[model samples]
Target: MTVESPAGPSTGTSTGRRWHVLGAWLLADALALTGTRLAAVALPWLALTTTGSPTAAGVVAFAELAPLVVAKVLSGPAIDHLGARRVAVGCDAASASTVAAIPALHHLDALSFPALLVLVAATGALRGPADAARHSLVPVLAESTRQPMERVTGLASTVERTSSLVGAALAAGLVALVGAADALAVNAAGLALAAVVLGLGARSVGRGVPADDDPHSYLVRLRAGWQFLRRDPVILALTVMIAFTNLLDVAFTAVLLPVWAVETGSGVGAVGLLLAVMAATSVVGSLVAAAWADRMPRFAVYVVAFVVCGLPRFAVLAWSDVTSAPVVVMAVAGLASGFLNPVVGAVFFERIPRHLVGRVGAMSTAVAWGLMPFGGLVGSALLALLDLRAALLVAGVLYLVTTLAPVVDRRFRAMDRVPVEVS
Candidate 1:
């Protein structure tokens, strides 16, 4: 399966080795995402069940993400210096052990709120590195093929998005059929599987262990990545855009939607349907991207992706949309989300040197995702003054306004034109 690079001109020979790498990567992503999602899905349940307090459950959410921002900023260079693969394996193993402990502690009736917070925070820290490592692996997996590499990266999203969807569903089923403790155990097992897949099978597929650059000490390298981000206006602007959108999206998903459902009598079934529509459609969008990569302006496509994602909220306010109609709307948002994935991939790697990729990537995601905690809390606050409909409309207008940010920034516009040489 020889595939061309997305860059231009030459084709990369897809050897049997590359396929093996691809399979291992996909499996690793599936297992890791499954574990993460499972734990996330069951978290609120655990908090509520154990504490029987809504405020306490909310505190759990805040604690979970609080370390993410700091950890991501701090872990970048360590990932690059230490090796993304090694970091991923260790992170997965640690996460698996921590999650497994949740059940063990519960069995003894010894679990406390602080203990839960520590475990969640540890998992969050691991998540940032795991994301960077797996993402950094994409280019290595399809080393010879540019177009195929891009496609592989795009396909990786499919694995993540799908596994995430399934993991959530699986968590619910496990919780119902078994218990929260058992669901957590399953999450731990999934993490163990992820570690095993990456540790044992990846290299057989054409993956390379990056040479020990030993460039700078971990902290020095971390500072260098930050310095790079500071200098690169395009990356910085896009990062800001992503960070802000993350905040808004989290707000909508966690706080606004639930309130709307309760007010409108949509019920849990509709909520599930709404989320499914979003997830399923995002998959469709990514497929479209793979099918039509030849036709899009990569940067413009990324911008449009954000626009589509933010558009539906305005639709909700204007149309008084219910869950049924919102599914169709959310699907479009999902598709845009799909289209957006590759574009981010394109830009994120385009700016950084290969050696710095893990640190930079991990740091970037952590910083971007760190904004969500605020978004959720803000959404909770906003719901007090306005209905979900009004709050969503505000979010939509704000998102639309932000879309121009990347377009107006000269550095981002010029990124698509920069020529690069990849071996």
Candidate 2:
């Protein structure tokens, strides 16, 4: 059962230590993502309540996400040069400080709208690198453990779903008890703890490819990643498809869902509750993917999952008046969505060389998220021109069309190819 290791030959000691690293990585990811999910709920609500305008809320979202995308794009060289573990630890610490400032300034009554935007933007910038570094650790960790990428990615997705479930519930309770401003303190703590845990445990892993022998400039390395990405038809297609889908997703979560809650008189609690339901069901789907995804046809599974998750949830929200109906639809959608990352991640990691993973992965992720900064603006603009239901239906149709790309394009069939080990 021996598999090639990226760092070196797989020894018994290294194999055992890989489990430790994997556990630490997953735990840190959970903590950091939980904090992020809380902020995701708190920040929009804070903006909405404070400004009393959806446009203002959209502006606040744009302030954060625009810097985030830029930071992610620029972070590729630093990650390849400095190592993923170091970058992750440093960025997480910075993110904690920035996030803490939001609550501190709000409490002091010094948090102007502009000041709030500044803090949010700083947090987003730091978080982009931290997230990219963390994601780049996955393939190396997978190789070390001698596990299929699908299993490790599935486990990661399960952790993500569980964290979302916990984070959403905690956000509801915190917002109820302390309001949105103070609930952010919990997020700060989580980020700080993640920094500590990962810094301590993943020190020996994630060193990335050493550059001592290579004579390439940083820009050259960065350009290499971009060139490879553009040349690969499969990855290129995935990036374009995911970019559009991510834009739609951000719109749904950040703007559309919040507006729906408010308009339905459901309050912030219901928003948190619905998100929790989706995350909870998603955990089940992730578990199933972790266990059986390697045996399945990736392209078929991906298509089916996308079909199930993409348009139905929006349709339910748009058409249904019953509280229970949307919840049920969201649960089903979440379950389908859980299989997505594992399938996509395995294909992505399989194609990229170990040496280029940091730069390539970051570039791909940056492109995939490039349009997200405008997602809130798009949702807000739709709301201005059309009613809430009309906006939802419009977005849903767009989503359906976007998700159909894999079926229409032959390149995506490469996802089902047997992956050659990329050392």
Candidate 3:
């Protein structure tokens, strides 16, 4: 796959060597996310078990996610300011230390609910910088001319989604075999591994832009990213679409899937397997997208993939009353996700400026993710009100259509033929 960013200033020409750069980012990133998600999943469970309080769980989630919102929103500027490479490498190391400290605390019984919350929060704080740096790296590694950044970015998405595959299986296996605390210990090591991978291959944030660190209040600096995003039509629409999906997807993962599995009598084991299936298929799908993305019209592929994503949620609700119906529905949803991400990367990469990539990307991702707590709440509520099948289908269909509406534009449809000649 040609990992070129056509929308930005022409930087370098493509060669066969660049995809290795892409894969390295993917593997390192996969580990980064694997650590993040595993800690998210395992820490909460460990806290609940130790303290036996729902408050502990809520605090952990809040501590981690709240920083995500602020960090995400502000990270764009931070990335621009700090340089993507330093921020990426440094933050990963910070995150590793944060998670690693937890197990020792647990052993000594120093891992109180408050301490755990703070530890995870520290990890969360570092994550935003790492996230921004990685996104900036994508375009850098690719040639500005004749490079398909969407393909490269899509492969990144593959790793992001695939992290769920690695995290869940790792957490389940290690936690089940050892325990959540021990599993968390293992997760810290994985994070260190990821840090080494990306840190070793690290490049500077690129030569094209300087991080504007004019002394100012953080919010003042952060608002620059918001203002930048709001003014760009393509970016605005794409950000909205991405945020909506983020909200719905996070809800499904944290709340709905568990409920659906239990209600359907599918057992927790079967439900866990659902993600593994999703990840495996997603890897293939991402590879396909990366390999073939340059050949097709980006918009047409997006519209179709959007439908594939949306249609499956309805399948969940529509099939709720039938036994095994939930399984079939989830399978389809997994299949659809495999195809959805490439389209997402294509859309996001085509519109934004290179200099703005980290801030804009992080700002958008953070804002969208800020809705995740809401998603967790909504998913729980909907399950209480209706079955998992019904709640998910309704939410999925509504947001799916809402997001896909952006592609209805003629300008967007014409983006693919615009050529890789960066201005």
Candidate 4:
């Protein structure tokens, strides 16, 4: 278990700890994601309860997410130049301070809406780079431990899902017991702890560009990342496809599902139950992927998982009246969805050169998530133009088409090839 650092065993420090780096990275990632999920719930709730205006709450959300996406797109070069470990530690520490300010200011009766907005926005901006840096660490950590990328990314995905489930529940309980402001303080504490864990344990990993490496200007490095993505058909296609699917997912979760619940007389509780079921099953799926995904064909698994996880839920919601049908569909879909991230993560790590991981990964992620903010708007528009059932049907068809891209396009065949750095 005594694995060498990227610089090899000559560094004279890799012989003592077994899996400490990977363990610390996972723990840090879990803590950070949990804090994020807590904020996702607490921030909007605080805005709504304090301002008593839904529009103000919406504005707060927009303020946070818009900057986050922009920052992710721009932070890639910084991550590559300064190193993932440094950037992640710095951003998380800054995020902790910024998040702590919200509760502190509110307790003193001095937290205005505008000030709250700025704080939330700062946390969001910091989060973008923090997240990208963490993602860039997976490949390095996997190599250091001599572990397969599928296993590492699958574990990461599982940690992500588990943290989200736990964090949302925790946020709700904390908000109910002590209010959103106090819940936010707990979030700040989690982030600060994550920073400490990562800074101390991951010192040898993600050490950034070497001094002897080419020192390209920031803009040139950024452009090089974009150009690489544009030339690589597989990653580019995956980016576009995932972006559209993300939009549809947001639409389904944010608008369609709730509207369906109301129209079907299932109530809000049923909506929560359905999502809970999906998330739980998805965790199980991630575990399976973590164990066996490396043995499976990446292309086939990716295609099948997307198909299962995408169109079926929409189809079930649009067409079925049986109470148990949607639940069953969600369980199946969640299980299938679990295999997705591991496969995609392995492909990206296998294909992208180590030097460009930060820039390429950041740009790809930013693009994939860029459509999410508009998802609710798109769903609302769909409902405006079509009936509920019809809108669901349309969304389902779109998802089906998007997921089938891999099967139709030959470029995705490269997913099955041996790992080779794209230079």
Candidate 5:
């Protein structure tokens, strides 16, 4: 299906060539995400098992996510200045070096807790910019390939979910076999490979910087992006809603679920199993969203997806003693979760100018992810204060209420309007 390019003009690349370019970007993204996913599981597990303290695990998680959010907020100008492909390559290289050090130090018996935190922090800082760089390239890729933004977004989401499924399974096996610290080496390798892929494949893609050059101060440029986001009510609404949801999600994934697994005498392998099923179903959801998103009302699909994605998983985990029930609940949630990004992506790409995409996209995502660093710590503390069921119940109820805001509030219906192009 043909759709207007977010950039207002297509690159005129042949259909086959466009698909090839899109394919390369997708594969590189999958590899990069796989590496991060591996590190995600290994890092927290290392902290939890080695220190035997949930608080310590939360601290490690905070170290990573906090730096990442800061980096993402500040990296917009740098992406525009250095170019997306270049930034992606540099960031991945830096991540690989930092992540590899964890195992290297451990093998030398030189890995102190503080040193590990420093290394993980470095990785997080690199990850934020790298992720921004990759996301900034999405609109460009879709325009170049002449694909609909919704379908491209859906495809990208699918690739991410698929990689997470594979990456989680791989991480679980590696952790079980070679131990968590050693599993980090796989992350390092994946990052290195992703760097190589982008360097080679996206060499000819134009840098994301705008045509009108400005010598404005960094803060001024940053403000310009912020101003644009503030002016757009839809962007602001989505950002607020997502920030809340992401906070709950991180809390659940990073701490609560794992803690529950331990309490139930279910191994890390079971944790992996639950996550894998969710990711796999998410892939299906993304594909379906891609095929039919155009036919559905964006607002309706978005709200319904969030309704399914939220509440039930938490409720099931909290109340159900049966393992299979929670798994099924998560699977259903994942399926709904898959449709969300495509709608958001379509709107996001359509509204922002092609030139400002790097700066604006970075700022936007940083805002959405702003609260995530505290999620792990808060989740751990809640487990300490409240029983598991009560904590989950609180999360579930809060999620249901907050996630429904977009549906209940009249302002969110603006999401259905055609995007007004920013100058």
Candidate 6:
């Protein structure tokens, strides 16, 4: 099947090629996410193993994610102007190189704490734009294939989560077999392969903004994206709600859970097990959403998903002595979270015009990721200031408040309304 290019369909474009296009993009996305998950594991492992300090680990985490948020915020206009496909390839290549550097430096005995921080930060910075570029291609692929946008969105989310599961499993084995630095090398190779797959399979997407299409200053165009987000009630509500929840989730996954694993004698292996299980269950949820989510009221499904996905695991950890209970809670929570990404993706596409997808999407991502960089630091600090039970309790309560905000806010009710596709 020939896929249509963003500029226009070529003579070779055919409907039969739709599956091929979708498959290519999906493979690329999954691979990219897999590499990201590996890096997530490997980076922290490196810090913890080398420094033997949770504070150092938190600093490394902060260095990686903080630059990522800032870079994502700034990448919108550039993504639009440069073209999504181009940006995707460039970012992936850069990521591969940067990731490869870590293992190399370690092997050479030249890797310092500060240098590791800088390298991880570089990888994070590239990741934000690459993700935006990849996500921005979804609607284009859907339109060309004449597929339901929501289906594609659900499938994409599922693929990403599945990759996370696979990646986590890979990280654990690689770290155990060789070392954390070697696992990072594996991440680099995955990213490079992803870049190749995307380059070959999805050539027809991402036309990019022409030079003369919008001659406005970069900041002016950025303001335009911000304004669009501010005016859209449904998107606005979703953004705020997700942002708060993301921070809590990050804290749980990056700090609280790992600490729990160690404190309970469950070890790093248990942490990997929990993460993999949660991601696998999340994939199950995404599949269910793909099959039936469109038939339900999106807001209702979304709100319920939030309720299940948030706060419960923290509470479980705080109250239960048996590790098995937290696993069950996490699995159930993951199952509930499956419907979330598709709902958000569909709503976003329905409301934001294609021409503005890059910018608006970037702004939306920036907001969602805003607090994530500090999650590890905060979680560590909370642990230091309070006992494990108290820290978990505080996090659980905060999560509860954030998750409930949407149910109470009138603006979020707009999600119940039918979505219309923007031109």
Top candidate (TM-score): 2
TM-score winner, 1 or 2:
2
Per-residue lDDT of candidate 3, residues 164-246 (tens digit):
77777676566657777878876777777877877665332233344354676767766766777687665566566666776
User: Each candidate's TM vs. the true structure?
Assistant: 0.85, 0.96, 0.81, 0.86, 0.95, 0.95
- Clash count of each predicted structure: 9, 0, 4, 0, 0, 3
- Which parts of model 1 have CA positions greater than 4 angstroms off? 1-14, 45-58, 144-149, 175-182, 204-215, 261-268, 313-322, 419-423
Please list the C-alpha lDDT of all candidates, in the order they appear.
Answer: 0.68, 0.88, 0.65, 0.81, 0.84, 0.82
Clash count for candidate 2 is 0
| Tens-digit lDDT string for candidate 1 (1-423) | 222222122235345545665688789889988777666656755665566543444566666677766766776766655566777788888878878888888888878889888887787777766667777666655464335434766787777667766775676577667776678898899889998998887644223344455555767767777777777666777787888888777666555664565568664345445665677777777777766753678777877788887857555733664665787787778778887776677666766666667667777777778787676576666665676667777877777877767767776685465347422
Q: Per-residue alpha-carbon lDDT of model 6 for 130-175, expressed as tens digits?
A: 9988888777777877766678899998998898889888877888
lDDT of 1 at 395: 77
Q: Rank the candidates by lDDT, best first.
A: 2, 5, 6, 4, 1, 3
| Candidate 3 clashes between residue pairs 3 or more apart in a chain or in different chains | 4-147, 4-148, 76-359, 80-211
Between the candidate structures 4 and 6, which one is better when assessed by TM-score?
6
> Candidate 4: where is the Cα deviation over 4 Å?
1-10, 15-18, 41-61, 102-117, 175-182, 206-209, 212-215, 255-273, 315-326, 383-393, 419-421
Residue 407 C-alpha lDDT in model 6: 69
lDDT of 5 at 214: 67
What is candidate 4's local distance difference test score? 0.81
Please state every model's RMSD to the true fold in angstroms. Answer: 4.9, 2.7, 4.9, 4.0, 3.2, 2.8
Clashing pairs in 1: 4-147, 5-146, 5-147, 6-146, 6-147, 17-205, 20-205, 21-205, 76-359
Cα lDDT of candidate 2 equals: 0.88
In candidate 2, which residue ranges exceed 4 Å CA deviation? 1-14, 206-213, 419-423
The TM-score of candidate 2 is: 0.96
- Which structure is stronger by lDDT: 2 or 5? 2
* Steric clash count of candidate 4: 0
